[model samples]
Target: MKILVTGANGFIGSNFCKFLVSQQIFPRVFIRKNCDMSLFKQLVPEWKQLEYVYGDLRDKSSIRPAVRGVEYIFHIAGTIKGSSWIEFYEGNCLGTLNLIKICEEENPDIKRLVFTSSMVAGGPGTPESPQCEDTPSKPLENDWYGISKYYTECCSKKQTNKLPIVIIRPPMVIGPGDKISFDLFNIAKIGIKVFVSGTPRQFSMVHVEDLVKGIFLCGTHPKAIGETFNFAYDGTISYRDLHEVIATKLFHRKYGNLIPIPIPPPLFYFVGLILELVSKISHEPPFLNRPKAIQASASGQTMSNQKAKQILGWKPKFSKISALEHAGRWYQQQKWL
Candidate 1:
C-alpha cells in the first residue's frame, strides 16, 4: 500500500514511521523543510527504502505533490506549542482545510485520510464521567490549542462527504522521545511534585506506540470511514497520582520523601501573565503561558476509548505503570533525568 505520513519527523509521527518500517512497509514521509530530523534519524535507519517529500502545511501548493497518488495520508502535522492563537490557527485550522482541499483536487484515489486530532478538542469531562465521542465540545475560549484542534475536526467532518477521512483524538501521549512527558519526569527526578492547586485534575493518556497502532487501525479499518474515535487508555488518573507514578519509577522509592509543593491558582495565573508579557517583548514563546495555565488549573480532563475498541478492535498494550516505567528507562538511557 502506498502511504504518506505527514509530520513524520515529530514525536508520534516519527514513532509511526518506525512502526511502518518494522512492519516491512516503506512509506512516503512528508515533512517541513525546517523540521528537526534528529528523531527520524535515530528511529529509522533504513532511509533508502523510504521516500521523502519536502513541504509545509501552510503552503497549499506544496501539499498537492505530497498527497497525489497516495492510498492513505496520515495528516499529523500541526502546531502544538505557539506564542499566539494565530500560529495555532494557521497551522492546525487553515492547514487542515488546505490539506483537505488538495486531497479533493489532487488525490481522488485516496482510500483513507487519517487525521490526528487531540482529546482536548472534545474538551474535558468530569472525573466521575469520562467523555465519549458523543460528548459535545466545550473548549475554553482561552485554550487556543484545543480551539485549533476542534476547528480541524470540524473541517475534516465537512470534507468527509467529498473524501474518505477518519479522525482519531488522542489524549496526553506518553512514551519515549516525548518531550511533554519528559518535563514531568525531569521534575520528578528532582524529588519535587508541583501541583497547580489543591484541586486534583484528572487526565487520560495513551502510550505513543499504542496511539500509532490506533492510527494505523483507523486508516485500515473499513468501518472507520467518516468517523471519529477517541484513542485513550481505559481509565483516568489524577495529576497527583501521575506525578507519584513518575516519582516512583524514577527514584525507585516510595512517595513519602518527595516534596509536594502547591502553587496557588492565582500565582499560577500571575506566572502565566508574566510569561505572556515576556513573550510579547522577546518575541519568543515562554514555556508556560495563559492557555497552559488555564488548562493546568482545570480539574477534569478524561476521555473514553470504547468506540475505538468496539469499532476498530484497538486496545492499549501498556498500563499506566508499564508506560511510565518504559519512559523512565528511556530517560535514564538518554541521561535526560
Candidate 2:
C-alpha cells in the first residue's frame, strides 16, 4: 500500500512511520526541506524503503506531488506555537485546506485521509465529565492554535463526500521521543514541581505508540470513515499526579523530598502576557505565551476514548505509570535527560 504521511519527521509522525515500517509497509513521507532526518536515519535498513518528498504544508504546489498516487494520507503536520495568529492559520488551517483540495481534485485513488487534530479543538472537559466525540467545540477566539485545528476539522468535513476523512483528536500525547513531557521530567529532576492554581486541572493523555495505533485503526477501519474520535487513556490525571509520576520514575523513592509550588492563575496569565510582549519584539514565539498560560491554568481538559474503543476496537496498551516509565527510559537512553 502506498501511503503519504505529512510531517513525517516530527515526533508523532516519525513514530507512525516506524510503526508502518515494522508492519512491512514503507510509506511515502512528506516533509519540509530542513526537517531533521536523524530519527528516520536511525532506522537504517527500514529507512531505505521510505520515499521522501520534500514539501511545505502551506504551499499547495508543494503538496500536489506529495498526494499523487497515494492510497492513504496522514495529515499530521501543524504549528503548535507561533508568533502570531496568521502563522497558526497559515500552517494549520490553510495548510489543511490545501491538502483537502488536492485530494479532492486529484487523488481519486486515495482511500483514506486521517487528520490528526487535537483535544484543544474540542474544548477541555472537567474531571467529572470528559469530552466525547459528540461534544460541540467551543474554542476561544484568542486561542489561535485550537481555533486553527477547529478550522482544519471544518475543512475536512467539506470534503467528506469526496474523500473518506477520519479525524483523530488526541489529548496530551506522551511517550518516547516527546520533548514536552521531557521538559516536565527535567523540571522535576531539579527538585521543584510546579502546579497551576485554581480548581486542580486534570488532563487525559495517551502514549505515542498507542496513539499511532489508533491512527492506523482509523485509516483501515470502515466504520471510522466520516467519523471523529478522541484518543486517550481510560482515566485522567491531575497535574500534581503527573509530576509525581515523572519524579518517581526519574529518581525512584527519593522524589518524596521534592518541593511542590503552585502558581496562582493570575500569575500564569501575567507571565504569559509578559512573554507575549517579548515575542512581539523578538518575532519568535516563546514556549509559554499568554494564551497557553490561560490554557495551562484552566481546569479539567480531559476527554473520553470510548468512541475510539467502540468504533475502531482500540484501547491504550499502557497505563499512565507504565507509559511515563517508558518515556523516561527512552529519554535516558538517548541522553536527553
Candidate 3:
C-alpha cells in the first residue's frame, strides 16, 4: 500500500515508521527542511525503499506532492510547546486544515488519514473516571497546545464526508525518542521524584509500540473511519504509583526509596517563569513554561482505549510499568540517559 508518514522523526511517528518497515511497508516520510536529521537518522529504521519528501505542511506547494499518490496519510506533525496561541494554532490547527484542503484537491479518493492527537485536547481527567472518546472535550484554559489540537480535531471531523479520517488521541506516550519521558526517567535515576501538593494526580500512558498499533488500526480498520479513539493503557494510575513504578520497578537500584519532593503550584510557576526568561535568551521553549506549569499543577489526565479494543480488536501488549522498563533500556542504548 502507498503510505505517507508525517513527523516521521518524532517520538511516536518514528516508532510508527519502524513498525511500517517491519511489516515490509516502505512509506514515503514527509520531513521539514530544517528537521533534525541526527535524531531522525538514529530513530527511524533504514530501508532501501524508504523515501523522504522535504516540505512544510503550511506551504501548499510543498505538501501537495507528498499527498498526491499516497493511499494513506499519517498526519502526526504538531507543536506541543508554543510561545503563544497563534503559534500553536498555525502549526496544529491551520496545518491540518491546509493538509485537508490540499488532499481534497490532490487526492480526493485517499483511503484514510490517521491523525495522532493528544489526550490533552480532551482535557484533564480524574482517577475516578478516565477520559473516553465520547467525553466532552474541555481543554485547559490558556493551554494553547491543547486548545489548538481540540480545534483541529473538530475541524477534521467536519471534513469526514469528503476525506476518510481517523483521529487517535494518546495520553502521556512513553518510548524511545521521547524527551519528557527521558527527563522523568533520568530524574528517577537520581532517586528523587517531584509531586505537586494536592490530591495525587492520575495519568494514562501508552508505549509507542502499542500506540503505533492503534494508529495502524485507525488507518486501515473499516470501523475506524470518521471516528476518534483514545489509545492508552486500560485505566489510570496515580502519579505516586507512577513514581514508584519508575524508581522501584524499573531501576531496582540502591538508594532504597525515592525521596519525594513536594512543591506547591506557586513554586512551579516560579520555576516556569525562570525557564520562560531563559527561553527568551535561548530562543528555545523550555519544557516547563507558564502554561506547562498550569498543566503540571492540573488534575490527573487519563484516557480509555476501550473503543479501539472493542472495535478494532486491538489489545495493548505492554502495561505502563513494562513500557517504562522498555523505554529505560532504549534510553541507555541511545546513550540519552
Candidate 4:
C-alpha cells in the first residue's frame, strides 16, 4: 500500500506522516525544495522511516515521479496566507489542478486522493448555525484563502470520476506542533490577552490527532470516495474561554494573571494596517490582515461534525479545552512556548 503525502512538512501533513510511520508504513513525502524541515524533523526522530521526495505541486515535471504508482495521495498542500489573491489562487487552485491532471494521466488507478479543504470554504455560518457538507459554499469575498480552496474543491470534484477524490474540510485545527499558534502561546507567556470585539468569538476546531485520524479514514473508506465531510470537533470554543483554558489547563500549575485588554475596531485595524505595511515589504502575510481581522471580530465561525461522526464513526477523543491542554504541553515540551 504505497502512499504519498504532499505538504508533508506542514503541521497536519507532517503529523499524518508520523502516524503512518507508527503503523509501519513509510509513506513517501513530497516537499518543496529548500523548504524548512525543522518542525517535521523535530516531530519524527526516526526520520528515515519516511521517503522524502522534494518537488513543487505547481511543477509538473517535479511531481510526476511523486504522483506515480502511489495508492493514496494525501493532498494536504495549500496556501494558507499570501500577499495577494493571485498568490492564493496559484498556491491553492492551480497547484491542486496540476496534481489532479498528473494523477489522471500518470496514475489513474490510485485508490484515493484525499484533499484537505478548509471549513471556511463553506462558510457564512455562525456557531449557532454551522455549515454542513450539504450546505452550499458561500465563501466571503474578502477571504482569498477560502475562495481559493473552494475553487480547488470545484475543480477536484469535476475529476472525481477520473480519480478517486475525497474532500475533508477541517475547521480551525489546533494541536501539537502547530507553528501558527506560536504567537498566541508567546503572548500568553507575557501575561496578556487582547481582543478587538467585546462579544466573544465562537469557533469550531479539532486537534491535529483527531483530524489526521479522520483524514486516514477518508483515504481508506469506500463511502468517503467522491464525498465531502467536515472534520471539525463536535463543539465550539470562544477566544476568552480559550485564554482561561490556556492559563489554567495548559500549564497545570499556578499561571500568572493574564490581563485581558479590549480595544476598539479602529485601534485594532490601525495596528493591523501597520503590520500589513511591514508584511508587504517582507512578502509575508500579516497576522492581522483584513480577512484575519474579520474572522477575529466575527461572532462565530463553525462547522458541523455530524457527517463525519455518522459516516466515519469518528469522534474527537479530546474536547476543546483538553485538546488545547495537550497542544500547549507539547509546545512547552519542544520549547516552542
lDDT of 3 by residue, 101-180 (tens): 99999999999999888898998887677788887999898778888899999999999999999998988888888875
Better of 1 and 2 by lDDT: 1
1 or 4, greater by lDDT: 1
TM-score of 4: 0.93
What is the TM-score of candidate 3? Answer: 0.94
Residue pairs clashing in model 2 are none
lDDT of 2 by residue, 155-232 (tens): 788888888999999888877667556767887777777778656788888899999999999999999999999988
Better of 3 and 4 by lDDT: 3
Q: For every model shown, what is its TM-score relative to the native structure?
A: 0.94, 0.93, 0.94, 0.93
- Ordering by lDDT: 1, 3, 2, 4
Q: What tens digits encode model 1's per-residue C-alpha lDDT throughout 1-337?
A: 8999989988899899999999999999998887788878888888667998898888989988888888999988888777689999998999889988988899876899999988888887765888788778877668899999998898789889889899889888888788756767877778877778777888888899999999999999999999999988777887677778888877875965668888887798788779778867875445567766777777677888889999999978998788888978988898888
Encode model 4's per-residue lDDT on 49-147: one tens digit a residue. Answer: 678889898898898999887899999998886657998899999999999998888998999999999887886557778888988888876777788
Q: What's the residue-level lDDT of 337 in candidate 3?
A: 68
Candidate that would win on lDDT: 1
lDDT of each: 0.84, 0.83, 0.83, 0.82
Model 3 alpha-carbon drift over 4 Å, by segment? 253-256, 276-287
Give candidate 1 regions above 4 Å deviation.
272-288
Determine the backbone clash count of candidate 2: 0
Runs with alpha carbons beyond 4 Å of true place in candidate 2? 43-45, 254-256, 270-287
Residue 162 accuracy (lDDT) in model 2: 87
lDDT of predicted model 1? 0.84
Per-residue error (Å), model 4, residue 234:
2.1
